[model samples]
Target chain A: MFAVHTEDLRKEFTLKKGLFERRTAVAVDNISLTVKEGQAVAFIGPNGAGKSTTIKMLTGILKPSSGKAQVLGLDPWRQRSRLVRQIGAVFGQRSQLWLHLPPKDSFELLAEIYSLDKKSKQYKSRLEMLIERFELAAFLNTPVRKLSLGERMRAEIAASLLHRPRLLLLDEPTIGIDVVARQRLRELLAQWNREEGLTVFLTSHDTGDIEAVADRVILINHGRVIIDDTIDGVRHYGAPKSADTGEPPDMQSLPALEKVLSDLFTAK
Target chain B: MLKTAQKLIAVAKISARANLAYPGEVLGRGTFLLVVLYIFLKLWQATYSESGQSKLAGLSLAEMLWYLTITESMWMSAPKLAQQVDEDVRTGSLAVKLIRPLSYPLYCLSANMGERLVRFSFNLALGACIALALVGPIHLRAEALLMLALSVCLAFLLDGLGHLIVGLSAFWLEDTSGLYLIYTRLTMILGGMLIPLDLFPGWLKNLVVYLPFPYLVWGPVHLLSTPQAELAASFLELAIRQLACLVALSALVALLWQRALRRVSAHGG
Candidate 1:
């Protein structure tokens, strides 16, 4: 079964214009999509393109105005509690960690929040592995406010994984980190997907994130999916080939790929 | 059930630790409480001497001061639940909270209670010291102290309900501070923070007796000052009334919260 499926799912927000005046705008307009289990799909769009709205709907944070949405074969809105148990989410703009406390303390709090078995050896081992894998031991005891943006992001990801969620929803998870930190995060996510078969649905402005982590790309604009294709397909479609020689342009260059994606977005 | 309890405990523990991390805030609050206590001592003394009476409504000057100490402790020690709610709603953090498996109201309640527990303990000690210095000592029984503790716990829960109501109003009202201002004053006058209900005219006192506001302060403070022999009878009746108020308030909060969740737009996301 698919990890996420939506059929004509839509959301309409009523904005108050003035006294006794209201205007309704469509945020997610009749979007039907699906992601198979273990697939890393990038949901990319410009600002105010309804990307965050869609993620919110899928995560049961917002109820849809019409149609249906199911995450892990459960209606996200109606069965939110049960669905949330099987999913972990991280939004870069907001944090779930306690800011005044250290990552280690927040991790313990999260473990309790998720109701993990304290007596289980596997739970302890898993936590230890995450701490090491995320390289959190170096500054685990440092308060979250004192941690660098890169360190905090790593700790945030590690905290999300505490529940052993099958599907991870990341919204702009690499927005403000340094280049090296961003690259490191992408690699860690890729490794996790490959080794543990973790299904990832990520929204990011950085095309580098798409190139490094996403095998499938879904381009959205005006609250609708403009293109759903493989990363290679997107690259080939947008590549500037030599007309006379019929040779494919260098696809490995990051700038070339980014330009092509932007050109495609503009063309659509 | 047990899992929910554990989650709440963890929330409270983290909140307590967070509040303690900044000692300056607590110190500032302690200083304010002492200042307020000093003002009350002088005012009550002047009123007693002017009236030329050792007792007003069966309360000596010492008894009245002790009563004020307890009531003020309840008032001053409450955590700022309304402001926290306003911040969450305004920032769209409420949406983030909804997505979690935890209940938003319960989480807020637990966190605030944790902070309140720490502040209340400190204030209680400070109030005791101030009372001892100002009014000397009064006769007290062990049973009366136990009943006083129970009354204070119930008073705290009742005060929480009042704050929850004001805070939850933020779903519809843009600013709840206006509502909170009215609530604070109403609780002070009718709930017996500024003056004991017994000191009020008979008709006003009788009317307030039927209101839930009095249960938060007057009932508890009265229990603390009640004579030892009368404690058993007074405790049973007051305990029953407090329990009923708690249930009613919980139901109202639950109903309003259900409606509020529907109206949550998560505006800033």
Candidate 2:
């Protein structure tokens, strides 16, 4: 039950430029790696470090430019419909849930989309349990746009898990969440993974999100992997020892993540 | 299918609630359309009175006013230029639709139709009621009833086509809003909502008859009064042309959407 495998998975984008500038940008450079079954993998990098581009290709949301990949024993790009049912993807920047409809309505909608009969008590019980655990009972009938961010994310997670998928892909899963809510989400993920043997591949800027959920880190920068190793290995490789003030020297002197990533790309 | 229809109904119901939330937009748009409609009515009357004219096309001033009112409401509510479609593509929201078993275009079509259903009903109740009070009951012959139903369905299809063009273009164009606006204005000006197509010169009418613009408004209204033989021929012509446009443009939309997905994945959308 291989969870993910890639062979030189590459993606490129055409550049919009003036007469003299380069005509393309390599958004995801050639890369190859595998995550075993039930492993909690963290893909971490500054924005535009090819993290999302790589995830999109893995989830079959986008195709690779010059390589191949497989997820759960299927070609993600070629067999998207078959692959989709086996995994759930949550995109924090955008949502799959209907804005005007209630969370329950969107859940039913997805159930219909996945073509699972609503009368199936097995699925019904699973959904109910998820709703309860995620604390969605309060806002089950509330329209999605009206739900608080934490509530929305909870419902979003619940919606994705309705089918008991074997794998979950969460992009910025804990973004915009308060500390307590983020912790709760991590707890839920860990429990579900242990109980159901579910595999989670997460990408987040929150160190806590990575620390709590992912044992392995795939650190990327400028569309290439800087390190792909165990979390401790990544830490030992050369994380900036925190200044006594608990802030990195890079952060004290740098504008933001965007600037940091830009500097990395420019210097590299 | 029932679920899809129910979903659309839900969309319509929710839109009604949303309208309540934004009272200002409802009031502002309603008043803007009414004032614009009133001015058109006054201008038409002034022109006819100045010419010492009474009627043309066997229609009195009141009947023409009725036509203008319905046209304006339909213009405001017409199903073209789906606002959500462009955003759906640019924001990658359509990805949500793709994972669903529901057909993508069909889902969008239903949601949009739900919205238009609300607009059409509101306009019929508000705009039509006021006009009938000022003017009178619009006489609908038996054949005219059929034509109205047929043309209105065709109108919906035309509106979908308008949105389809813009929605599909988003895959290729970085920003599609300006182009959609230009396209919308062209239809409004030429679709007989601004003025009766009959009022246009003979050559212009002939030219537009071949184009898809007249089917949007004038064709249906014209079918309301025209003889059976002529209406049948025109209806058949319009149906075929509309179907043709639907197929050709639908194919183009599919192609562009596929290419766009590939582009976004490669570009990190």
In Å, residue A177's CA in model 1 sits off its true spot by 2.5
lDDT of 2 by residue, A1-268 (tens): 6899998889887776876776877888888889888989988787788887887788777788888799999998888878888888888767877776688877876776666778989888988899888989988988888987888898898899987788898888888989888999988887777777888898888777887888888878877877788765554434343533554334344334333333444555
TM-score of model 1 relative to the true fold? 0.93
Q: What Cα-based lDDT does every candidate model obtain?
A: 0.84, 0.74
* Candidate 2 colliding pairs: A113-B101
Cα lDDT, model 1, residue B117: 79
Candidate 2 lDDT over residue span B115-183, tens digit each:
666666676567776676666786767876776777776677667767877876777787887888887
- Model 1 bad stretches (over 4 Å): A236-257, A260-268, B266-269
Instruction: List the pairs of residues colliding in candidate 1.
Output: none
Best by DockQ: 1
lDDT of 1 by residue, A1-268 (tens): 8999999989888988999999998888899999999999999887767888899889887889998999999999899999988998988878888888899888888888888886799889988999889899999999899998999999999988888889999988998999999999999888888888999999898999998999999888878888889887676766545432566545574245577677866774
The candidate scoring highest on TM-score is 1
